[model samples]
Target chain A: MFWRETYIVFRRQLRMALRNPAWVIIGLVQPILYLVLFGPLLEPIAGQLGAQNAYTLFVPGLLVQLGLFGALFAGFGLIAEWRAGVIEAERVTPASRTALLLGRILRDVLQLFVQGIVLIGLAFLFGLTGSILGMVFGLILTVLLGAACAAASNALALTTKSEDVMAPVLNSIALPVLLLSGILLPMTIGPQWLQVVSDFMPTKYIVNAIRELFTGDFFTITTMWGVIWTIVLFAAGLYVGTRTFRKENA
Target chain B: MIHARGLARTFAGRGRGKEKEEVKAVAGVDIDVEKGEIVGFLGPNGAGKTTTLRMLTTLLKPTAGTATVAGFDVATQSQEVRRSIGYVSQSGSTSPEARAGEEIMDHGMLYGISQKQAEARGRELFEQLDLDGLWTREPRAMSGGQRRRLDIAMGLVHDPTLVFLDEPTTGLDPQARANLWTHISDLRVRLGSTVFLTTHYLDEADALCDRILVIDHGSIVASDTPDALKRQISGDLVELVVTDAAQAGAAAELLARIADTGVDTDTTSVSARVRGAGHEIPGLIRALDAASIELESIEVRRPTLDDVFLTLTGRSLREDA
Candidate 1:
């Protein structure tokens, strides 16, 4: 019954998403620009990952980049929905609060996945190469990260209930996480202290794991840690999102 | 179908420095609503009408006391209470991206209605609310009235036994308000659905509500049928507006002789509660004229819910909103 209710909300969100083409168009412009403009600049750093082509080494970071940035702003849609009285309207229904959060979180994941695919397609155009299995794992990791970030973003959005507060706070946290996650560059090339700092960041392991997968190296500690961290982030995000939702209803 | 005893809500003040007072949004409100009855909750700004409605709808927990809606405790069996009621809040759902019919149908689906049943119910509601030809148009393209009707339809799609409308006609034009009132009245007549509504419009309450609950300062000041409440304020109200503002006091005193109840005065007008004020208007005019007060207008006004509120709280309902 809960999943049924979630599906109903998910379908509504899906219709809303389909009706608004601008979200996808706008969401795609940033990561595509990074791929187009920044991918070539990382060629010198390719040797650090023992890769011949820089695009393969850099594309994995961009996949997570798409998810991180995409999911970080997912709460904007929810904030708008709240302002429209959609969230308040749902409060009167028999639908479970968990379903409400799950429905929206799933939609955000789907949206981020679409954006991830577009980024990957652009990566292929930019000469990124990898095993089919690696690409599949890469997509799954992006989606997991997106789900976690989007869930956290939604929890904060509901907590603050104001976009003015949400934006600056998310930016402050997102930029630091982005830099430390090594989304734009390999953290290993930086100073030993910087690498140590990056180790504390969860997305850093996912990035390293994906980079290893891109090189067709499946049997590595980096890949295992990446999976563990991504799963942890996923579980943590779902827990917080669901708890905040139930709390709001209460 | 609805009963509340000492239902109250309080919000703690923000800040740790100094003693910050907590705000009591709804303070000890008690109400009883029978099945298939239409009850209107009338109150001034910050009078806790919405807070009471939220508590009844299980959206907000009362800080004190208890209530049962649809035979289920609002605090405990909230899910059963929710399943048995429909709510249309003041700030309605106007999704700019969704077509009107689809919005209602989707809302019904959320409550576990099948698509076919939801569509049928949506169409019926569309016909009932005069929302035809809006199935294909997004709310952004519709007028405020159309969107509000859609909001009502969304609430009704599940066919609940009771409905709560919190200031449903607010922000609507007069014609739209009238149209919505017709549909609301029809809800009780056609479906036997109990309606608990909150409105700022006194005439709307007088015309539709079987009983009106007047709340001021977090307490229910009065609750009765409109005519019963109005009759408590004595006879018809005589509103005398004179040209000479200075003579208002003297005019009120003169009218007070014939009036059975108290006389009220403003800058240039005197309103006296009198038995048979319509028949006594000639005497009132002569007495005011003898006092050298030039009459601008003399209106024999019947006792309204506003007068009942004014007599009870020394405040006008129109000014309260």
Candidate 2:
């Protein structure tokens, strides 16, 4: 029943999302722009500075940036539904709280996946080729990271019940995560203290996980730690999100 | 069937930054709704009608007492209670972007009905509510009345044994309201589902409810069938529309002198509460004549639910929130 409700809500959300062509167009185009513009512009600096790989570094940062943006927007749709009294209606039904949360997270995950695919395609176009297995692993990492961030953002949205708060909060939290995750540049290039701070951010692990996959460094301890952090973040996000929802209903 | 006793719910104001004071939304109250009965829970705004409905539907837990909906305790067995009832709130719940048929089917599936059964039930309800032609149209495109009908259809799709409708016709036009009552009546007759409804429309309750419970200040002030409650106000109400404010006051004074009747005066009208209108009408007209109060109009009507509420509570049923 949880899966069924999640799928139905996902379908409904997608349909509603499609009605606004601007969102769809922006989502499809923004990641491509990040890949094409940011990747090439940083390539010269990467080579001169002996950076690991420009496209490899750029892809994870773009993925986290896009994922955070997408997850942050997830709450607006829910708030709109709440204001419209649709959420109240669903509450009166036998729909489980778990199902409700699952549905919302699934919708965000699906959207993030679509955005990731567009970014991946653009990455290949920018001469960022990878082994099929590496590409698959990277995509998997991106999805888990995106779903976690989206779920966390959704929890904030449901609790606040204000889109104005959600938008600014999303930007404030996501911007720093994107900047400090070593997505645009290698963490080694940064000051030691800054790298330590980046280590505390989940985006750092996400970027590292995907970068390690692309570099065929899957056996490293960092990869194992990154996987553990991804699971921890996803679980924490789901827990906090669900708790916020229950609190709102109360 | 539904049973609630000493039900109470208090909501704390938003945010930890505020004080810890709580607003009592639903105070101690008891109610019993039998199977296959339509009970109208009547109250003015803020009288705790919606709050009580929320408790019975297991959406809000009672702070003090117990409520068992469909034989499942609301606090302990909420999921079972939820499974057994359908709730339609004052705010319409259907998604504006969803087609009417899709909304109904989606709710059916959510309530645990099989996909095939959900589709079949959705189609049947759509046709039953006269929504067969507009199944594909989104709610935003439908008329207000159509949207309300679709909401009702969605509530009924799961075929629950009990349904709670909160101010179901508040904004509906009279014709639409009538149409909804017709569907409600049919539901009772066909499926024998107990319907617990709250509304400010006394006439709607008079026409449709088997019993009416008038609540005030978080308490049930009166509960009885419409006829029995109305009869408690006296035989009939006679309104002597006088020529002016002074004349209406004079008329009231004259009528008050008569036996076994009470006269209440207002700005432009004087209403006399009398028993056995057949005998009182002659005496009332004589008193008006003696006071030289020219009666512009005279209306002798049976007591209505409004009168019963007015007499019992000393206020109108449509008091502002």
Candidate 3:
């Protein structure tokens, strides 16, 4: 019943998304803009970071950018749903409460996957020289980050309950996370104290791992930490998301 | 199909030190409804009407007491209760972006019905509810009445044995309200669905409900058929205006004999509630004429539901609306 309910909700959300896909296209603009505008700047510094090219380094960071910021704003949709009484209506149904969270997370992950691929394809056009196998592996890490971020965002939406509050809340969270995770530049280029401060940011591991995987470097401690952090993040996100859904109006 | 005893809910007062103070939203009320009955809940704002509906529908848990809806316990067997009932809330739960028919189908499917059956029933409901040719229209694009009908279609799609509508016709124009009333009555006639609805409109209850329950200040104040409740007001209101101020006392004295309640005199006008005013009024007018009292105007009004509401609660329904 849980799986069936999840699939039902997922299908509904997917259909709604497909009907008005303007948001999906609009969501990709920021990452593509960064890739097109910022990739040439990273070329001169690529060799300094010991990479074959800037695309390999910059593309992975853009994936993290798409995954984090794109899915972090998923909460705004939820607040709209709450205002529309969509969540409260579903709560009255016999549907599994946890299925509501998982179904939405899966949808977010799929969208992140699509946006990541588009970013990757555009990166290759510019001059990215990365392994096909490694690119697929890197994309997996991005969607995992997306699933976690989307789940966390939804939990926050329930607590805030108003778009006026949610927009500024996500803004405050996005800035610090974007800078510390080194989404645009490598944290290693910064001073040691800065790197130390960024060490506390869990997103840094995923970004570093994606950059390594793009260079066909796998089976390393960096890759393991990234994989572990992703699983932990996804699990934590699901836990908090499920708790909020169950706690809501029970 | 529904039975509840002392059903109640209490919320911790919102904000700061107020959290320690508990506010009773539903202060214990008993309710009962047999199958195929259309029951109306009438209450003023903040009167716990919605709170009681939430408790019965399993959208909210009662802080006290118990309820059985569709033969399942709302607290312990909520899933079974949910499967057996449909609920359309006050706001009418439809996303502005979703197609009306698809929203109904999705809602039905969420209750464990097959997609094909849901679609079939949704289409039939649309046709019956006069929502034809609007299958693909989004709620945001529809008129106020159309959106409300779409909401009703969503709730009825799965064909639950019992349905609850919270202020279903609110915010609608007079013509739209009249149209929805027919559809609401048809539910009990066509599908044998027991309806429990809350509304601010007295005429809606008189027209649609087999019985009405009046709730006030977190409790049930009165429950009876609409006609019976109207009868509870005792008499028609008779107001007499005298041509001269000095004649107000004479008019008041004459009205007092036929008045079931006390008569009121204010300068040139005198008023009172009199039983069987249609029969008693002619003699009183003659008595005034024989006493050489000249009358300015006289109005005798039949007791209405509003009069009953005023008598029971000392508050008019429209006061807080």
Candidate 4:
């Protein structure tokens, strides 16, 4: 019954997404810009990192970045729904609270993957190539990470109940997390202290894991740590999201 | 059907540096509603009508006491209560971007109705609510009245035994309000559902409700049929606007002998409640003529729900709102 409602809600949202093509286009612009403008600048360092193509090294971080930035902003739409009484209307229904949330977060995950695939296709056109297995693994990690962020973002938005506070707080946290995750450059090439700091950032595990997967080192320690951290983050995010949703509806 | 006893809701007050205080919004409200009846929950703004409705609908937990909506405990068996009841919130529930028909259908689907059944139900509601052509339009593209009709349609799609509407016609014009009132009045007749609604419009309550519950502060100040409540004030209202400003006091004094309460006198006006409205007008005219007060005009008016509220709370409902 719960899954049925979740699927129904998922389909409704997907239909809305299809109706609003501008959102999809806007979601694609940032990742495509990175592939177009920033991919070529890293070619000199590509040889130093022992990679024939710099696009392969850059694409993984961009995928994680896509998920991180994309999911963290999902709450803006929810806040609008809250103000419009859509959330209140849903609360008065017999639908499970878990389903209400799972449906929305699942939509965000699907959006991330679709846009991630678009970014990957653009990378291919720009001369980026990698093991198909590695690319799929990276895409999977990004979706999971995006789902976790989207869930946490929704919880915060509900608590604060204001876009004014949510926007700045998310930016403050997102920028530092992005920088420390080494999306622009690998942390290993930076100072030892900076690398130590990056170890504490959860996205660093994801970035390193995706980079390994991009290089076809799927069975390595990086892959194990990446999967474990992503799982832990996803669990925490789902727990927070579900609890907040239940409390709000209750 | 709905029954609530001592239902109360309190929220932690916003405090800075001092101890937090609890603001009691719905304080010990008791209500009894029979099946197939339309009851209007009337109150001034901030008088806790919406809070009481929320508690009854199981959206907000009561701080104290208990209630049963549609025979299900609002506090314990909330899901059962929700399944049996539909709610139209103060803000219309339709999403601005969603087409009216699809949104109503989706609302039914949320309550476990099949797509084909929900669509059929949606069409039935649209026809009934006079929202036939609006199915393809988004709520934002429709007028305020159309949106409210869609809200009612959404609430009724599941065919619940009871429906709760919070200020269903607060912001509409008179014609739109009248149109919505007709549909609301038909709820009990067409579906055999109990309609519980809250509104600040006294005429809306008087025209549509079988009984009205008046809330002031946090408690229910009065509850009865609109006519019965009006009759509670005693005697018909009389207003006279005399030509002689100085003689108004004398006319008021003369009318006081037959007036049930003390006559109210302004510069050139005197008004009071008098028994036997049909018989008292002549004597009042004669008395004023005898005093040579020079009558301008006189009106004998029946007591309205507002008069009943004014008598009980010492304030007009309009000003209170």
Q: Tell me, by TM-score, which candidate is best.
A: 1
lDDT tens digits by residue: candidate 3, A1-250 = 7888898888888888999999998998988999888888889988897677998888988999899998999988888888887887888899999998888888888899989888898888898887888899999989988998999999999887988988898899899989999888889989999999999988999999998899888898998898889889989988888899888373
> Compared with the true structure, what per-residue lDDT tens digits does model 1 show for residues B154-195?
888999999999898888898988888999999999999999
- lDDT for each residue of candidate 3 in B1-321, tens digit (9 for 90 to 100): 989999999998777854478899999999999999999998877889999999999888898998999999999999999999989988768889988888888888888888899899999999998999999999999999998988888888878999999999989999999999999999999999999999877778988999999998889999999878877787889999999999899989999999999999999989999989999999999999999999999999876656877988887867876
Q: Candidate 4 clash total?
A: 0
Per-residue lDDT of candidate 4, residues A24-97 (tens digit): 78888988898889888998878887678898789999999999998999998788778877788888998998
DockQ in order: 0.66, 0.51, 0.61, 0.54
Candidate 2: regions farther than 4 A off: A15-22, A186-196, A245-250, B13-19, B232-310, B314-320
User: Candidates 2 and 3: which is better by DockQ?
Assistant: 3
Candidate 3's docking class is: medium
The sequence of per-residue lDDT tens digits that candidate 1 reaches over residues A1-250 is: 9999999889888888888878878888988888888887777767775678787778888888878988888888888888778888887888999898889889988988888787878788778888768877888998998999989989888888899999999899889889999887778779999999988999999998998887787889999999999999999999998898888342
Report the error of model 1 at residue B179, Å: 1.6
Worst 10 residues of 2 chain A by lDDT: A46-55
Regions of candidate 3 where Cα sits further than 4 Å from its true position: A248-250, B17-19, B234-309, B315-321
lDDT of 3 at B20: 77
Candidate 2 chain B worst ten-residue window by lDDT: B253-262
lDDT comparing candidate 4 with the true structure: 0.88
Per-residue lDDT tens digits for candidate 2, residues B1-321, read 988899998887666777788887777898998999999998778889998988888877788999888999998988888888888887787778767777777778888887789889988988988888887889989877888878788778888899888888888898988998998888888888899999877778877899999887788888899777766776577777887777776787766665346677777787776677778778778877876788888887766656677888887666644
Docking class of 4: medium
